[model samples]
Target: MRTIQLKKILNEHCIQFIEKKQMDLSLSIEDANSSLHSASNSTAGDKHDTSRAMMHLEIEKKSKQLNEVVQLKKLIPILIDNSQQKSFGVGTVVETNAGSFYMSFNAGKKEIEGQSFTFISLASPLAQAFKNNLNKKEFQFMQKTYTILKTF
Candidate 1:
């Protein structure tokens, strides 16, 4: 399997996730704004004030989520760096007894063409284990032993 092709697939998945999250956050923010505007014109006294406060909280929460999604988008290129695959680092695909992993983001397991690829960050436990012991035959993780078959 080509590592470049695998990286492209993983990047596509990450982009799709970012797009979906952006759309969801946008909708949430719009809804919160609408509610806040409605609360402003209402004359329910204490109830209206409470509703306005709640809408403000919702907008704040959605704003934070949007910020996080934007940061993830910025990290995409850095996550999939096209560097030399000397050892298990960023942009490298590691094949182990546990599974095939694209060291990118912690987006969890992604199955493409019937094969499973667990996208993990370099700071993750599994990636840390594969750090210095690149070509080693076996290693232990969570009390379970795993063999490093190949890395690219």
Candidate 2:
């Protein structure tokens, strides 16, 4: 697989995940707000208590998921859309003799064209190995050495 192709795949995956996260957050927020409204309007008794408890849980869960979605949104800008130039940073697709790897800086593994490539975060250990290196440099991962064939 080529670096450009791998990059396209990673970009698609990131977009899909972001969309799903956003949708989930929106739905959760709506549900939580509705639950709160219903709890407030309840006549009193077990129904009110149950609604209150459910609302609290929904709010907590939604808040956590919203935070995660925000973080993921921040990473969207890191992905390089221009394929003209290549760099040794997150969002850059790296090609090695062994296989292609997409450095998402946010997303996880994504398979492309029958090749199981690891879409690693920039903070990951393997990414650190090639952090500041340029194209044609050799990076060692675990016990294996991979030569940087190309970047895009």
Candidate 3:
């Protein structure tokens, strides 16, 4: 596992968490505004209905964002230290003949240092493929092949 790749993975996770938080905040503000509008126009049933609809949409958006926040919280602990990661733990970078990749507890893909890398959560299919593989070994996915060259 390359240190640079691990750092990149952690940095990316941090950015994603920040973005999700921003989205959550924005949705909260929108929801509040919808409620206020609905209150102000209570005399008009149609306007109140429209505001209610908008509020529903905002609630859905906030719910999704909250779910994302929960996922991000699970990832935050792992991202805190890219270095000194436990063996076979999430956020531990793995070096392969194909390239350097980060093993995340959250599934995703990323590129680092001009190299394309796959980010797989601990429970992901690809992570399971490589898990418990102590020695250098070959891993095949969708006809593409990669070898676990080393572990840092």
Candidate 4:
């Protein structure tokens, strides 16, 4: 399959992943709230207070995580919008001597259309190397030199 098609598939996979994470975190927060309610209804006790406090912290943490996931889900399409690139940009994949990387999110590897693609954040060291050297075909990261064979 072409890189454009494969990138679209990768984008869909990333969306699915974000949705799953958001759902899981939401459920966790709900469960924690329920536990907190149950703990509060019980008689005042040191253990119960501590349990409630812990549940409150858990709920807060999960809610923050869910918010971050929602932002990331919104960003995926904007970053990988299938626009034509003059040089390597947000929606392009950089193929190097080391491996193939999708310039989207750090969603790990997925095999789509018989091609393996590693979704990486632009802030990542490897992606940074590519982003900085968009004009050049060669760059070094982690003591290894990577030569960009092509961009998709």
lDDT (Cα, 0-100) at 7 in candidate 4: 67
User: How close to the true structure is residue 146 of candidate 3, measured as C-alpha lDDT?
Assistant: 74
TM-score, model 2 to reference: 0.65
Worst 10 residues of 4 by lDDT: 80-89
Per-residue lDDT value at 43 in model 1: 86
**For candidate 2, what is the lDDT?**
0.72
Q: Per-residue CA lDDT of candidate 2, range 35-131, in tens?
A: 7987788688986888788888878888887888888777776564443345566676666777777676555566676766667777787777766
Sorted by TM-score (best first), the order is 4, 1, 2, 3
Clashing pairs in 3: none
Candidate 4: the clashing residue pairs are none
What TM-score fits each model? 0.82, 0.65, 0.63, 0.88
lDDT tens readout by residue for model 1, 73-100: 8877775665345655777778788888
* Better candidate number, 3 or 4, judged by TM-score: 4
Scored by CA lDDT, what does every candidate get? 0.81, 0.72, 0.66, 0.81
Candidate 2 off by > 4 Å = 43-54, 81-85, 94-100, 130-152
Steric overlap count per candidate: 0, 0, 0, 0
Off by over 4 Å in 4: 80-83
The sequence of per-residue lDDT tens digits that candidate 4 reaches over residues 1-152 is: 76666767777888888888989999999899988998899999898889899998999899999988988988876866553555666767887888788877778788766667888877788887887887888977889989988886
The CA-based lDDT of model 1 is what? Answer: 0.81
